[model samples]
Target: MIVIRTPGRLSVRLQPRVLAVGTVCLLLTLAVGVLAVGHGEYPMSPTDVLRTLTGGGSPAEEFIVTQLRLPRLATGLAVGTALGLAGAVFQSLVRNPLGSPDVLGFTQGSATGALVVVAVGGGSAVLAGAAALGGIVTGLLIYLIAWRRGVHGYRLVLVGIGVSAILTGVNGYLMTRVPLMSASRAMLWLTGSLDGRGWSDAVPLLAALAVLMPALLACAPALRMTELGDDAASGLGVRVQRTRMLLLAGAVLLVALSAAAAGPVPFVALTAPHLARRLTRSPGVTLLPAAVIGALITVLADQVALRALPGQLPVGVVTGVIGGGYLVWLLATERRAGRL
Candidate 1:
């Protein structure tokens, strides 16, 4: 740990392995991003893509790269980064591998909110607003319901799982009650497509991340200290409950904004942080590395979904398949280690 202290303010510590892993992941994300931009139906060469981005290409090339592809690419990166950071915070808080927005009912709650708006003929903005509202409400509900004297990690996970099941059922019922066209729209949204996304979709997510990520990072030292146990953390002068609440709030906001932008893309949050941890060999979560990995996975998954199938499938479908397999493997590994 490399601690840098200013005279009056709090100190920031950097780990060398985390920095190295983050750099590698960032490079990989850039490579995947370039590939994603260059491999579409109207494929452009890497040189052409770069030229277009740098304002040196012709009208059609510029249109394809800037107007058509860049927005989707930007949305994917922002959504992935938000999800990964949120997931890292939640998993660290709960001290469980399975603790994520998707598994903990927050995603389902957001989906339910959006589906309700869509079913009632709301437009994109309204739907996004509703989704964020629903996620925040659900997160609060889970936190309150799981609290006895205070929240326990296992209890919180269990409550979230139960709440998630209920929300899933509610979403399904709402789908059945809506008009066929509306239902189709809802289904497509639920599957989490990046199709036809523009700056309208991408910008809000980017803005949200810009605000929330720094707050999450600011809470990082408290988060790490809290992992040493609440009593120890308190003894070390960290305000344990306040720190947890602040971290939880940051995590929820990130999840809400990401879900609003991309309709709850599955498992990126759940999988990316763990992968980052492994890569860095870090005892605690590596937020920057996790964010980079998430962006790479999302961009790569979107690329595969677009090209690997007869029709363009939703990005969530590809991630769901991959994440399902990862989930099974995780379960097996945990069982072998007597952690399950």
Candidate 2:
């Protein structure tokens, strides 16, 4: 008797479950965003929000929903997804759950770039492009410097931290040198405000994500192999350096897109992958799931921030409160385990 083993494509076989979860998360995000649209001082109902979105509401309501809230909601979702996907990619490539754009300074680089553009009186679109370029440049520089034969996760983290500190100083100096009014506006952007965001702001973010996410997803198989130790991966015919470079580039692109959209909303990129890994109980971070979780967290957080207080709070503030607390807890736990 002869025995045969069947080979299967794990990723494709899991596609249905992945698709189901993604669809559910997307619907939930839409529902939350819709409800949030109706929630400010003017207060439209969900039906009103839908009617406004679909061109059936009163002009005033339409303006509020379509012009004001819609963009904010869309930006929140787009930024969240970008950060989440970036976080997942970084965490997987580095084989460390803590490897995220925010943690590693890519966000700071993007922020610095955007700040320079804003300080120089550039338009918002230009500012976004500048931010993306900054993030990519900084990420590539760090990767190149950290590449000792190949990339090491620890070296990357160290270089990133240094880069972050340097950029932060530059950002502060730029803010201080600018005229008061311009500085004030730049500060708002720095703090990640959704105020006055219209369809215009939403357009670029959505477009970037549309173009970038597919490319990142296509890199997933290589990402998985690279997560196996470099030696093991190389033995299995993976071109470790080339694959890692590609992965790093994809991660940087996603991160830059996110930072440009939302002014480097802190901690989302740092925390979302860990949260996704924990939630799915997966051995490693998966990009698609992480993006979904990131979108949900931000969309819901924005909803809470909008209505939780007597006045509107910046969505970043909401994420900061939760993410900061989690970071503290994580540190404490690591210390207790003698791992910090």
Candidate 3:
């Protein structure tokens, strides 16, 4: 362990393995992002993509990269980063493998909100707003229901599961009641694609992360302490409930932003933290590594959906398939270990 300090103002303790994992994940995310940019009908070379990004390419390359692919790539990066940070915070706080945005129904809330807009013929423009509102509302509802004097991990997880199931039903009912065209649009949104995305869709999410990520990072010590249990954490001078509330608020907003931007792209939130933890073999919260892995996973899944398949499948479909397999493997592994 090496400690870097700027006199009395700042100090950072670094773990070699964790640092290495985060570095690798960051590099992989950039590589996948480049591949995504260079891909599609135009198909620029990596050299062309890099050169164009640096402002030294042909007009056509400039237009294609700047106008077409960059916005989508930027959106995917932000969404992934948000989900990863949210997942790391939630999973660490709840101490449950099942504690994720999708499992907790925040994503479902976003879908419900978007479907409501479409059902009322509000069109695509306001769908992001509606989705964000839904997620925020759902998060609040779950938090309220889970609070009994103070929130417990098991109680929070149970409340989330129940709320998620109810929201799933509500989403299905709304889907059935909508018009055929609206239903089709809702289906696509629910599947979470980056299709037809531009700067407008990317900015709000990026802005939300810009505001939220730093606050969450500042709370990282308390977050890791809370994982040691509330009693112990409180004894250590951590305001356990306050920490929980702040973390919950940040996680919810992150989820809302990602859902609004990308329609709740799956598995990235659930898998990123775990993958980061496994890679680093770290017992503490792996926020930076998780965020990097989340970006890599989302971007890579999107690239697969766009380029590796015959008919461009939705990014969510690719993630769902991968996450499902991973989920099953996870369940079996837990069962055999008698932890399930």
- Give the TM-scores of the predictions, in the order they appear: 0.90, 0.85, 0.94
Cα distance off (Å), candidate 3, residue 264: 1.4
Which tens-of-lDDT digit does each residue in 1-340 have in candidate 1?
Answer: 7899999998877888888888887888788787788877788888888878889999988888888889999999998899889898889888888889988999999998998898888889899889988899999999899988777677889999999999999998999989999988898888887888888989988998888888888888888888888889899999988888888888998888888888889999988888787667677767778788888778878888988876899999987676556656765665335332
What is the lDDT ranking, best to worst? 3, 1, 2
lDDT per residue (tens digit) for residues 188-227 in model 3 = 9998988878999999989988889889999998898988
Greater lDDT among 1 and 3 belongs to 3
Task: Please list all clashing residue pairs in model 3, or write none if there are none.
Answer: none
The best candidate in terms of lDDT: 3
All candidates' lDDT scores? 0.85, 0.77, 0.87
lDDT of 2 by residue, 1-340 (tens): 2233457633334544555666777788788888878877798888877877888988888777777778888888888898888888888877776787877888788878887887778888898788888898899888888889788777888888888889888888988888898887777767775666667766777897898789888877777877778788888888878877877887798778777777777777777777655444455557887798688778777777777865787778788777556656766664335232
Q: State the lDDT at 223 in candidate 2.
A: 74
Residue 190 in candidate 1, Cα distance off native in Å: 1.0
- Candidate 2, backbone clash total: 0
Model 1: runs farther than 4 Å from truth?
A: 1-13, 323-340
Deviation from native of the Cα of residue 212 in model 2, angstroms? 2.0
Off by over 4 Å in 2: 1-11, 15-24, 51-63, 324-340
The TM-score obtained by model 2 is 0.85
Clashes of 1: 0
TM-score of 1: 0.90
lDDT of 2: 0.77
